[model samples]
Target: MASESDGQGRLPTGIPWSSPTVRVVLLSTVLAPLGVPLISPALPTIRDVLALTDAQASLLVDRVGRRRVLIPSLFAFSLLGAAVALGPPYWVVLAVRVVQGTAAAALFITTVTLIGDTFEGVRRNTVLGVNVAVLSAGAAVYPLVGGALAAVSWNAPFAVYLVGLPVAVLAYRVLPEPAGERERRSVSYLRNVVSALPAREAAALYGSAFLIELLLFGAALTAVPFLLDGTYDLPAVLIGAVVTLTEVASVVTSALNGGFSRRVSNHGIIAAGFGIVGGGLVAAWWAPTLGVLVAATAALGAGWGTVLPSLDAGVSEGVETRFRAGALSFRNSTTFLGRALGPWLFTTLVVGRGYRPLLLVAGGCALAFVPVVLLLGRRG
Candidate 1:
């Protein structure tokens, strides 16, 4: 076999994201986060139509646990949703959401896995920052689209998933499946799975922070329209606009944070992100006015922008080259699990005590992780 390294140890195509790679990989990244945001603004209608409880109705992430259970899990659940929606039953739709969460987990994890595998040096860090940015960009924009579509109908959000199959095809044609070290590491499938663990744990935590931030942010975004319309009596359009404002803040923070992260240490930046996120939740929980709520949204977005990039960078840096994709997939699963659990946990609790208590609970959860994070850093 001809070595990809000219015996001097270098790649033939330069590296991942060299030119057009970013666009192709990004298509999947953009597709994955788009679903929840667009649906978040329309959630109340779905809740009423489906007769679902608060906990049953929010956004999240999770693992595949069945089938090939990797990349396929990303889009399979969406197809499942489209199938179930034909019957138009609420329970089936909710079940589809659970499946789709698994799919989202696979997609999110797989992208990072591929990216970590495909690049090295400056290219690796740059790609990680950009990936987080793009993910946030999708999260920021989709809610407005969702809220606008809600004006037409509730099920309109599900249409976003229809776009995924094409993105997957794009991945096949354009995304480079770089096999430098991984190809040489193992010949067994079970060995490959076991090999991905240690790196996957770090990547998973990075993905976890991102998803947790999303969870907190998702809770706020998912609840804000309801909060404004129900609490402040704003119109859906106005709520959508406010949500857009929050997205703008988030996107801006992501861009700035990406630049800032390059200049600072990853650990410090991540710690700050957790602190800001925890604080933002508490602030928003107590906010007495619409303006305060908006400020809180911006703060939360800023925190995420900081937290996610550092986490992504850390995970990418830590993983072994060959297992990058597999490790990342596992990481993505953990992130989605946190995200999936977040909505369920928050909404379930909120049903009893309302939104303020929900924020307080989320804030507490964020704080609770700090010591755990510190402990991880201190370990061998």
Candidate 2:
């Protein structure tokens, strides 16, 4: 088998922002985070227009294969994104969002798989950190833009989904499936995935990914805007601006992830990240001023930045190479499952109580995991 570094003579030490392969992967990865937050600032208006209760409102905001599905996923993302703008019935719009989520999934899994395909060792970790930074970049920008558009029309923000179309074209032109990837396939699909996951390390990594996203979407993404809107009466644009600050912190932290990874164990970073997230949520629970709330969100973003790249790099590096595709797909599934479940869990718990108690509860949940991770690390 040809090594991953065989034909690609790229520099191993420096970040490769100029490389077309890296650029396309980063561009595609951004859409994963973009799909939700782009519509987040508009959620209040959307709920009002659709006559949705807060619980139902939580349902609306919400991936696929690797090489074989990348361009097609982009097209699906583009088309479904535009379809939601047609002012369809509430159920139809929800259905379209569901499909759009699948496309975003494909883009995510494929992009990460490509990184593993193209880079190795510490360089791969660096690229993964850069990938998370760019992903946070998308998360940061869309809210402001979506909020502005939502000010005009609830449907206006959906147009941003069309951005995927051009990215798809660029990917098709520049991103080829890595050599030998097709040739390296094992005939027994289920077995390959299972083999990759036999290690306790792989299982722990997936669990960390799941927990990170669950706290993120549940506490930070889903609940924050509602708190700002209902409590503070902030407009969609302002809500978006605040959300942008959270992601901005994430971008900065993610850019420095490679450095942190060098100094800390992945297990240590994951534990500390969750601890920071828990502290942020506790701070949010106590926030008396918007400034305090902003600081809390920045803490949440920092925890996310510190943890996610380590998780991605761990999955890539820890798994055996031949079964990597399976491991990555499983990691992506856990992430999406966490994303889906977080809102539901929050909405269910917040039904009669409120967002603050929910924040406290979520914080408690995150903090409770710290020792469990430490225990696992000791055993491992």
Candidate 3:
């Protein structure tokens, strides 16, 4: 039997860059966020062509299973995502998107679950880190690609969703159903999953996942654009460049995640990441110069890089094998809920108050949450 350290190296153990499973999973991870970001630059055109309300136009951007689950979900994700380019009526496009959102959810959940099922120990942490890094890279690139495509046609970006088809086909050919998956579905599956987790620990993990996204979006990503525009008087291009720094820093940090996890407890990394995010947000609240804000946001991204992968790996590691998917699915739900709610929270809280106060509140909340993470981590 191989020790967990069997393939340890400076980079990470068993990266398997050329492995079909690795390629397919990483590529699928890359596609996960394309649903919204890739079409973002074209939103105005889409709205104009369809004569949609600003609220209605914003619906396009938003936040998925296994083999039998994987193939159909991927195909649905591809078709529905691509169908938006057909110049359908507003309602029709929205309907397709709603269904596509389901497929997208399946894709997201399944990818994480697949990793939990496939890898173990530090290797799993590293792979999850790489998956996140790939996601950050894709996120960084997609907006630029979408902008370029939007220049050609408002619909061109939608075609990028079709990339899912090839990946689906590749998955069918190469991805294996993990051993014992057939045994996973039992009459007691739900009960077992629920009972597998200690109540407080689960709360801490899920709550932290939700809180991080809430603050990341509400205080940082959502408000930073307006802040840069109004306060700094920066050009849209410059603001975008500044925003990209977060993902750039995220990519660098996440690529090193396995190494960090090997040294720190997942909970410790998560707690520290949260603190770092708080510090970044506090810095953003106080930033007097463009350079300072840029650096602050980059620090925030570094915290993001560390926390997300660790949260994912932590959830996966804590649950019993039989209950892993269930646990991860719950975590995914919280994560998406947080992402969806963050902007809303920001809007609601910061409407008359201003972005600075929201950043302070959100940062303070994140820092306050740190002790909770430490407590849960210690108990677990």
Question: Residue pairs in steric clash, candidate 2?
Answer: 63-102, 63-105, 63-106, 64-106
How well does each candidate superpose onto the true structure, as a TM-score?
0.69, 0.82, 0.93
Model 1 CA deviation exceeding 4 Å by range: 1-18, 39-104, 146-170, 180-219, 222-236, 286-288, 347-375, 378-380
Task: Summarize candidate 3's per-residue lDDT along 8-112 as a digit string, tens digits.
Answer: 533336676866777878878888878777888788888887788888888877442367777788888898889878777888888888888888888777888
Alpha-carbon deviation at 13 in model 2, angstroms: 3.6
Q: For model 1, what is the error of residue 327's alpha carbon versus the real structure, in angstroms, after optimal superposition?
A: 2.6
Clashes (backbone N, CA, C under 3 Å), per candidate, total: 8, 4, 7
Candidate 2: tens digits of C-alpha lDDT, residues 59-90: 77742235567889888889898888889988
RMSD of 1: 6.1
TM-score of 1: 0.69
The global Cα lDDT (0 to 1) of model 2 is 0.80
Q: Over the full model, what C-alpha lDDT does candidate 3 score relative to the true structure?
A: 0.82
* Model 3 clashing-pair count: 7
RMSD of each: 6.1, 4.2, 2.6
